[model samples]
Target: MSSKSSSQFSTFKDCLARRLISTTDLDGPEGSDDPLDEFTSYLASEVWPALPDTLYTASYESLSSDTVLQEMASDPFYISLDAIPIPTSFFDTLTSYTHFEDAHDCIRFLRKVLSDYLTEATAPPPVWKQTRGEKCEICERGWVRLTYHHLIPRSVHGKVLKRKWHTESMLNSVAWLCRPCHSAVHHVASNEDLARYFYTVDLLLERDDIQAWKKYASKQK
Candidate 1:
């Protein structure tokens, strides 16, 4: 990486570290320092090097053309049901635990319930819509055609797999965004960046360019 890019990355890493410390309660008996240390280490060892040049330079045609979308859809990286480890009998196990054996069993049951609740709570919201006239999720503009944007871009599924940060099920998630918002995303960030960081409508909307685009798109036909 160039010196400028490296410097920018360091600044970004520091900013992220501060934000994580302030905004998230990663503290435990092990202490808050460990989480901050681990996060900074992860950014240095894993995230910074994986960023792609295309994120800064990709054109709308490269990002939005039907050809590109079709290629991504046809890529063989899709996570099949067989690859997932959930046993077919897992739900049966849940059903069988009708009575608690002791305090430990009660704690286990409550833990499971809490785990399931958190999973359901943090899992990305569904973005697919059957109709075309609904307001755009990104800009909240009404009466516009919204397109389905793969949260983790299909084009970068291979990179995502290589990084081991996400699974096939996560890659298949999508968001409904307006044309300008969608275009601005690809314009500002590469497929790899999308897979790693900006993989949600909320994250994409945080970008300065996307925020500007949303303001502009909200005023258009």
Candidate 2:
């Protein structure tokens, strides 16, 4: 890349960081301005750290971070929504040093990083340090049959996919709760509201109604 191109890339990085800090929410990043740049920047800065290893943490898996940064820095990348021709030379170079085994591996890891990053940034923290197998995650009631409540709800899944509110895998994420606690959660918010804003258990637990439900239902039945 020429000096001018390098400068332009740096400017894009700065602009994106500022946009992220000031913007209260991200809706439909697929349609966001400069998404290609934002994605590239995320890989370079966030994914490349190679820290937060999944070996010891159930949290986000940081792939070989340095390799990702080095790959992009050596030769830039831009993904196009429309089909575009690429030089054979670009592939030859990208293939030579890529840490991934193949194109499939590359895509899988990249997608995982992007999706997990969004969830971690906005979703509320975990309510418990550890979960009990038979207990309702909310009211901590054992002996009652626990039902898995889709935190985002299945009814709004179509909206979630269309709006890009969350990655598809996250739709299956659930919170274990007794039937009473599960019913109370739905009363706290509409399915759409939960899908967009309170898709995480911690976020649901933040609500006044949910907090009160824990107390009221702990002794019920």
Stretches of model 1 off by over 4 angstroms after superposition: 1-133
* RMSD (Å) of each candidate, 1 decimal: 16.0, 16.2
- Candidate 2, residue 49: lDDT: 33
Report, for every candidate in turn, its global Cα lDDT versus the true structure.
0.55, 0.56
Cα lDDT of model 2 by residue, 7-105, tens digit:
433543454444434432322245668654544465344322332222111222222344443333332332220233333332332244344455444
Q: Which TM-score value belongs to model 2?
A: 0.44
What TM-score does each of the candidates earn? 0.44, 0.44
Candidate 1 per-residue C-alpha lDDT over 1-221 given as tens digits, one digit per residue, 9 for 90 to 100:
76445544555455445544554453422445666666454533443343333222222223344443333234322212233333323323223333334444423432333233223322443434443347788779877777877879888898898987675556677777777777777888888888899887788878888888888877887
Clashes of 1: 1
Candidate 2 Cα outliers beyond 4 Å, as residue runs:
1-132
Clash number for every model? 1, 0
Q: Report how far residue 218 has shifted in candidate 2, in Å.
A: 1.3
| Candidate 1, residue 43: lDDT | 37
